[model samples]
Target: MTTPTSSTVLVPRIRGALAHSDRIVLPQSVLEQLLSEAGRESLPSPLTFRVFNPATNAYTHCGVREFSAPESTVLISPQIASTLGVSEKQLQASSTQDGSTPPVLLVSKCDLPKGTFVSLCPLDTNYLTMDDNWKALLESALQASYTTLTEGQTFSIVNPATREAITLLVNNLQPEKAVCIVETDLTVDITAMSEDHAWKSVAHRDAKRKVESGKVATISQDAPVRGTFSDLSQVFLFDLKSWDRSRPVIVELEVLDAGDSSERDIDGRAADVFVSIDEHPSKDYFLWSTQTDEKNVISIAPSNSFLATAEKITLAVRSCVVPLSFSLMVSQEEGIVEQKSAPAPQSESRQCPNCKQLFPPRTFQLHTAFCERNNLLCPHLGCGRIFRRQDGIPASHWHCDLDSFSCDSVSTKEKHILAHHTLATCVCGESFPSQQHLAHHRATICPQKLHICRFCHLRLPQESRDSQSDLLAGYTGHEFRCGTRTTDCPRCNRIVKLRDLDSHMQLHELQRVSAPLPRICANALCVRVIDDDPAAANSNSLGLCSSCFGPLYSPMHDPTGARLKGRIERRYFIQLTTGCKRSYCTNPACVTGRTNSNLPKLAPAEVAAMVKELTEGGKLEFCVDDGMTRRRRLVNWIGDDNEFARPWICRAVGEVRVGGEDDDPTSSEAKARSWLVENGVRITEVR
Candidate 1:
């Protein structure tokens, strides 16, 4: 953090107004005297500086960028004033106010250190004679154009498709001696300033990949050949190698010189010329492709599956724009030939109005003078092909007077007029017109595109930019804060959020399949339930309400319900011969609400034979209310019988509300003894 606040300034070279020579600018009162001598209020993140100069005593470092230069001057970049030898006529005689104290430099406030390895060296070898991948485009253009590296300082960069400047040379940094590449990551390397420039940059990148491995070649099966396309020959290959793994070859292709008319360019590049075949020329290994309109033909199939376990297929092809010509061939499929019902003699032929082919009337006058003087033919209209007049034509075949297209190369009509009339832009500031409409607006709907997130799985930018409550719930602000996390709800344990837990478990599976059912307490020994009070008291037969059949209420009119089955057999013969002595009766056919009082107490003729065998099969369910039969047999023997006594039985026969309480004018017995206290139905009561 070396900040003793030094200043001195005046190096001011600034040619082409700075776009990073490792940045500089300064002088707004020397950044307010180095932010008030470093107690700092603003200028820091990557604020560096250092500079030095004393007439080639050389020094460098840099960073800052814009304090609006002039006062004691600084400005820099003419490659940081030619790396400190500073003297564009001594910065134009110190910006002439008839004054001359110029080349001073020494600027201060440094910090430096963060470099983690650098190296660099190019100084020519045009990024090793560029075929692209120029060391990952010079490490993403030195991390998007430098912030400070220094060592021996050289810098340049350019080459956006051969604008060609290149330069480089920093050569070695690691832990210090001028480093701070702002937010560090460095590791670069590249090397070669001598070993005869690393053997002429690996012999000019192995003689342009040995002329791109002598343009692919191999091809065999049925012969047919012919080819073209050039900007260093856009792809081509061929191979196949003796197949026969149980027959199937095919392969085809036809075009024969086609280009300009399938119209495209605004960066989607086309203008007719197409060709494609694949097994890897990299459209991510696409397979068959064609496109030169008016039927240009293309094929592949030998049961493709990478040609049934490829030991050799290769093909490739590729194209897009160039002096496109084609033909190829391959053939194979045969085995299985028998039908000889005789009918063979046909080979008469004629056709050739200049390479239309079909010859034989005894070599139709020597194949029309060797196809009109070594073939040529193509005058465009439905383009037939031929070409070979010693391969000359394509120097700049034109067409597009703004989209009429054709273009064989003046660098494909200046890349089809800079991809369809120049405009471009988009790293997401969006502008378009070409580069194929900013690559179809960054591959369709570019809200800064990128994507991945699906709830913070991270890659980002599908742009809904969160919080206005996830942009009003349409989400994408990193999946609305990764759907605010939360969770629980495996069907209502309730916590929720993970993006509204799938509409909160789809509203609990739509209220568990449209809810309804649980009306309960028709007293199969009553574990309550009923009160959804639209003025309570549901009319009853024994769907009991009036306090569970109001102690067998009697304003009796019977209507052959055999007097309500003799009042439910006299309330189970008074709860089995005198024992409603209720201790919150847990009725196991109630003797004294039997909690197993050591059996044997029956006697009065076994209490009329246990009340005629517990009221025979008339199924008179034993009378309820002893605190709802001990809370319905303690929730049918302790809980969850389908979440609390589902259809509880132990002595059935239910329906017993004969005829009174005016057929339930909101029946009473204290509103059915607190109709399960407004039907909230939880259990716990037995005290």
Candidate 2:
């Protein structure tokens, strides 16, 4: 669709300009300018140019003999004016400095030989018709062109270059040989419409009473057509372009269904008739009947509250594509129209056992059934007593702990329900009443089944698109690769998901291997000052533990992988005199614990051996804890995974040595004392 190579400056027509009957009088200056625009060596005699009419979609070779006016302008005859979607008065009208008469906007974008039709219809109408009656053509069609026009018939016309179309209309028929000539006003007959478009609007609907030319319009219901009609309430056909009737084009109309006069409601408003997508009686989406403004138009989109995706709607609507015609009837509601409704009676009520409150008899069984099963309390205001199940009846006695249970709660009752009530479980591990429910959930609500566009944040289920060509165009960003994808860190051995590679490369902390020294800050960061750090190692604030003992270190993979020391420090109390176990059970001695029978203490070597046997047998594990401002030991591990450790192991490892400075952490006796208490063992018989 390239543009034409000619530009014309239109000027007003004046009297006594050497204009011929068929030729458009033009000045020499204007003619030369136009020829130059067309890139011609010389102007052709009776020069011809192509013009476009968007409304009637007509494109033909038209000649220009000459032109006129003081300034460079184009003044064509009325016939040419009408063909180009402009009025004759427009080209002939005088232009002031302020442009009293606005210039027509040309649709042509270029000044080339084979030009494009770039003009729009000056008139509001996007459509028009042609007929053979010369007299009538000028009268009705504004002298554009005509073939033949009959009443109550539709015709298709389009601008070949612009593709703008009009479904031509002829409301009433008049035959040449008719013996009887009726004097009634004619109505506008809608012959056909373009495919994939919707039509509505009370103004267009009421034009049915006007002539096919739409010259005369009225609001009367008196004009009769050849049919037995009942106030325009019918399912009209939509002339689909194709023969596939899988999903019909939905007609949305808002109207009031007038009921019998005696059954009218107190408000006198008409009963609204509507269709629901979900089939809920009260949740209707499409209006069945109604009246509105004359300008109201029908919606071409699918029904509201429709669960289908956009692609589904486009495909479904396109499946029933109708390129030719569709049925249309509009009911105008100038004011409120009332309809009557049948009376509805109330149901009988009964009492509840929990609160002795009244409920409808029909709903009482359902109300009590679930309550008794779930141990629910009376929901009535001011009543909190629970209901018990006794022979299918709700017995009262306890209170409801409603907050303690939910659908996901795995209680004894829920376990019993799952094992006994449901026969199958879904892939997501949820129980349903029947296979049908399970299948529906899997198809519609399953998280695993949800399709998300990797290119964007659009989460959608599987569905088709509106146009394959359109889908291919505009965007090339969608990528849908699923499942776990991991890659080894380029710098470190740590593995990371492919998508998180960018963030993983940012870990500067993993670059260094740290061997943490087992020294407390005494700065209150440690739960209890386990022990003061060696001045040399504590200065750098980076090292590994070598002093602590216990199984708390297991499970936690220390990057440095430090091994256990042969002997660890401990709290040892030599017996200066015999004393009760409770006397020493306050601090570190509590780690050793007590028993029903009195026992003697054990040597450190014996205690260490017991610890070795128990831990090696997979009986114990350990971990580490950092201290906080007011609290020490057992900090929450939620922020970091490594903070989780066995509580008993930490208690055993954090021993305050009561021995003389002469004792060393590597001493077998010291290790023995710590291991016994760490395992909560009494040194009794071994001593």
- Give the whole-model CA lDDT for all candidates, comma-separated: 0.59, 0.33
lDDT for predicted candidate 1 compared with the true structure = 0.59
Best by lDDT: 1
Alpha-carbon runs more than 4 Å astray in model 1: 1-356, 359-367, 370-375, 378-417, 420-425, 429-441, 444-461, 464-479, 482-498, 501-503, 510-566, 570-687
For residues 16-114, write the lDDT of model 2, one tens digit per residue: 222211234445665556666668465433344444454456532344454443344555544345434465455545444555553432323211232
TM-score of 1: 0.26
**Per-candidate count of clashing residue pairs (backbone under 3 Å):** 9, 70
Worst 10 residues of 1 by lDDT: 649-658
Work out the TM-score per prediction. Answer: 0.26, 0.17
lDDT value for model 2:
0.33
